[model samples]
Target: MAETRPVWVIYDDGSTGHMEIPEGDGDPALAKPGRLVTEAEYTARLEEIRAARAARHEAEETARLEAARADYDALIAGGFPEATARRLSGYQGTQAPAA
Candidate 1:
């Protein structure tokens, strides 16, 4: 049977999660009071966190782009110059459909 232990984490963003880990290195980012893991657990957790972060970043970027597009369209409707609107809104694409 594999060994496991209870670990509580207090994160910087005022968040927390439960882990079956042990106190090892004094790393703040790992686990509160810290925790150790088996090679298998480490690898699996590493992949999981990476995938989660990537998905979150992609979603954020998509939202940012959408907001920028909205801003660009609003500015153009308000009679702002294209260059000024693009500059302020962070939108570089042409507003009209291709010919």
Candidate 2:
């Protein structure tokens, strides 16, 4: 009955769905059947959204890793052990501890 609250109903197929019942006005069409989207359609839509998000995440991760690699390379060039450099190269976090 709240203005922004959503009304949900369980279908016979065991699926839960929502109907927005506006507090001030209720449309008669709300009782009518809702639009049914195909499974593949929903899957494709979600996949596209997830792929875009993942692409951005991968780009940021790559930038961070490359920066870390550069720092490790600098350490190796400064006479640090290859093992230490390799360990620093693979570390993933906000800040790397002093070697």
Best by lDDT: 1
Q: Model 2 — which ten-residue stretch has the worst lDDT? A: 27-36
Q: What is the lDDT of residue 80 in candidate 2?
A: 81
Whole-structure CA lDDT of model 2 = 0.61
TM-score of each: 0.60, 0.44
How do the residues 1-99 of candidate 1 rate in per-residue lDDT, one tens digit apiece?
Answer: 456666554344444455653445343357344354455655666577778889999999999988998888888888888889889999887656122
Candidate 1: count of backbone clashes, pairs at least 3 residues apart or interchain: 2
Q: Candidate 1, which ten residues in sequence have the lowest lDDT sum? A: 25-34
Q: In model 1, which runs have C-alpha deviations exceeding 4 angstroms?
A: 1-36, 95-99
Runs with alpha carbons beyond 4 Å of true place in candidate 2: 1-44, 91-99
Score each candidate by Cα lDDT: 0.68, 0.61
lDDT over C-alpha atoms for residue 12 of model 1: 48
